[model samples]
Target: MGSQAPGKGAKGPRILNVNVGVLGHVDSGKTSMVAALSTKLSTAALDKHPQSKERGITLDLGFSSFSVPLPAHLQHLPYDELQFTLVDCPGHASLIRTIIGGVQIIDMMVLVVDITKGLQTQTAECLVVGEVATSNMVVALNKCDLVPAEERPKAIRKAQKRLAQTFNLTKFAGVPMVPITAKPGGGGTGTSAAPDAEGLEELQAHLVAMVPTQPRALAAAGPLLFSIDHCFPIKGQGTVLTGTVLQGAVAVGDTIELPGLKLSKQVKSMQVFKRPVTKASQGDRVGICVTQLDPSLIERGLACAPGTVPTFNGAVAAVEKIRFYAGQVPSKAKFHVSVGHTTVMASLTFFGLPDGQGVSQEAALVQMIENLGRMALTGVPMPFDKSRDYVYQGALVIGAKFDGDIHGESCRLAFYGRLVTLINPSKPAELQQLRVYKMKEKRGVIERINEDQGNAIVRGMFKKETDPAIYTGLRVVTGRGEDGVIESSFGKSGKLKVHFAKGIQQAGRSSSDNAVILRCKRYINEHDRKRLRQ
Candidate 1:
């Protein structure tokens, strides 16, 4: 459909920037739905990943933009424009992390569902993430062309029932689900090449009715907070960063700082949806040309702001382990925490004193560490940077999604919280000692010995370490307090062998009967750990 010219004597409608993310299970037609909608306005195709072309599965986040005309009745409204940034998120379980990244910037979502498949595992995961991100939602009953005509109504009804129950507490409960056949190349075909089941025009109108355009009031007035999603170099443009401006605005020549990276750069130029603009504000998907920074240094998950970005090593937040998360999060247990597009390994401590005291007794902590019932307010150990303030004061604290089992197919969400505190750096000596102990833990276990080579065997903490310098000569202490040096790897199993510094004849314990635990010469004083709690 072509855009109608503005009525004479009236100003052309201003484009309202809105971000809508597409999510669903693999083969649920999310990308195809995006393509179907892109044709309605000036939009590029959504699936641009090379692997997407090869495997027909979206491997990463794909983006496109299009404009929808305001309804005739609403044409007189202050904002007569509906410009939407369609973020197509990957549907495969392995790529859920990418979907979480996309969710951070989107104002709302369009959940595509394959009519025949109904709700799948990843589909539910997508919804859960959307809930955690607090994004508004609309459901797209896609692939109507594939379902048999006689069975279509039943499928739609069943889906509605399931969705209603799923969204009982959500604002989108009872939200309309548009049934449409989303063809790959943009546009849809009904049974036997008929017109779209839910016409494209109707879907467009529904989108506008369902999701309100973001207000420019606070978004334009607040401090700038832009979470970068992609960065690359344009031959003449130097380095360009593309992302949705989460808050405030930035003009050309404005200086931006990335506290997490400890770097600052100047904004050489800026564009909104490819149109050169003097400035870009919140909610607009923008491309920023930066000067005095290497393109390779730019990465996703880093925030760019006009003022100082608060750096934090950790946060205090209300946490809840999903009912399905069966794994235990022992104190100091390593879990991968993903918030926005950044994932980092973090340690979790269930027993936090009102004062920074030493770790609580295991029995007491275990009793209080209930994964079910009301959400528990807990302290998570974030990466500590000693050079900056130890707390984040930003209004928006990135909430991490905890996955206790990274290798499993289960879509379990274990943790959710805002970053509040940064790792305290006041005690450098104790912190350094802790680091040495962790490094030793990563490489100090002896599995067995090779009879022919007469050497005890071991493996690197990460399964294997090709760089011998990292493990060799490292000091280690065993469970029985036996001191040793990491000699070498046994073979390929990531196990490591250590040679004891002194004889153990008096103890009379063989390597087979004994185990090892990494230790540091200077351990964190129990008193120091207690002081931190204060």
Candidate 2:
């Protein structure tokens, strides 16, 4: 998707948050359903937005605020002032990148599917996007009443079956595929109550179960990462940036920098909704008045961070799964990726999966050549360590089914950034005869019946580092790069380049200790116990 103008006002911090995104294909009833569910006060922007009103389309990312009543289920939360923020994303194919940009930060999702069409291309695309972002999802079968009164049952079942295939519904299989009359015209107020069925009570219960009361793991001092959704200028106020406060807290007089800009801003004033607030926490949407800096520096994809997060020029990201919309050709071109509000344009064509890795390797993220003929930011900043990968950052268009699968200006053929093998910066396209593989298969290393290397586990480069680095283990893992590889031939000067981390050095050890490496023996014995219990 092309860039969008920043949102109104600046951003401040508020603590309690439930950030959610609405998703589906174009005309899949995402906006209308969102407007209906949001409170009367919350429905204003969505109701008045020009694109939505006149063209009947959601052009840019739209924002509205709402609070979900904690139902009988959430009375146990540790804090109050909790609320839900619903971000309405464009369901069209063109907005795929922008859709994921917002979804990356959301805690949960409400996937709206049209009951009449059942499941469309955007539905499946968005489903994969949601899965990649977060596991929690609520399926709202909008426009259910449009189906013949009797056909509603079939419509509802169709939704239920499709949902089970794509989402992790173990939390509650009986979730509400709530049949809703989601049109904005004439008395189309949304369902304030959960749908009626034996499924109704169960669905309401599941909504409470799946919708986390608060962010799962809120870091105390990782870094302040503010993803700017809206950037605008004021008469005397200078410039202000607004969006949900993604992470960390900001205070008055704190200096904030525009990501790519050399200058920063000082906080002038801050407000959350209507109330004046001081320090904001992860999730609250606040407006901050900043003094200093050029407004031009503040752009939509600009990420404001206090301390820098570790970024690699080239990285290998595992594709947990590669799925596509039925009947649509999978996007064959290399993928351009956008995560955490930053878009990296790389010509990452797909390679086969890794064969002998310990854990099942997903699709790998490789660094590709920047198609000067195709994109702007050729090099993307891929983060490392203590990172939380969102399930559906957005939708991926598989190559096989490309054409008629996408519609209108959305099906616009464009080059994309892909996660690919980082060539040794010294030599581009270094793989001469050696085949490229993203190691994603599952492998686990266990000690033999008797061996001195009792504490170590051997596996692929992709699995999480399980053993203490002190063990002097030789495990394979992905490497990062800047210079391209020179040659494919294996030789002394051309060693398969590997990076040594500070922690891996700590894994150094000569002999065993602890009476007999008791932990290993205990683990092996308990393994059989666990299997039996399962």
Q: Which candidate number maximizes TM-score?
A: 1
Please, what are the lDDT tens digits per residue for candidate 2 over residues 1-534?
000112235342223457778888877766666655555232224635665566677766766655545444545654433466677888877677667777866777778777667667677667666766666777877666666777768768877787766554344244456666655232332223222312223333444566554435555344566667767777877677776655566666677655455346777766555556555666656667786646675556444454353333434333322323222212234344555555544433333333354423231223222111111112323463212222121222221123333563232223222333333322334432123332222222222111232222222312243222312223332111111111111122212222223212122233221111111111112213212110
| Tens-digit lDDT track of model 1 for 1-534 | 011123234455556667888889988877766765663321223555566676777877767767867656546545566677888888887776787778877777888887767878888778777666654677888777666679878877887787778667555577677778776233321112223435456667666775543244433666777778887787866788887777677778788877656777888877665566666677777778886667776567555563446555554444545444455645556566665566656556543222133443333234335531112122344465322322223322222344434345565665555553344434564334332211113333445544444345544354453555445566666556756666766566666766764643232256533555543222243443311110
lDDT of 1 at 533: 16
Report clashes for each candidate as comma-separated counts. 20, 71
Pairing residues by index, what is the TM-score of model 1?
0.65
Report lDDT (CA) for all predictions: 0.59, 0.48
Off by over 4 Å in 1: 1-13, 39-45, 70-78, 169-172, 184-199, 212-219, 323-331, 351-409, 423-534
Worst 10 residues of 2 by lDDT: 513-522
Best candidate according to lDDT: 1
Q: TM-score of predicted model 2?
A: 0.59
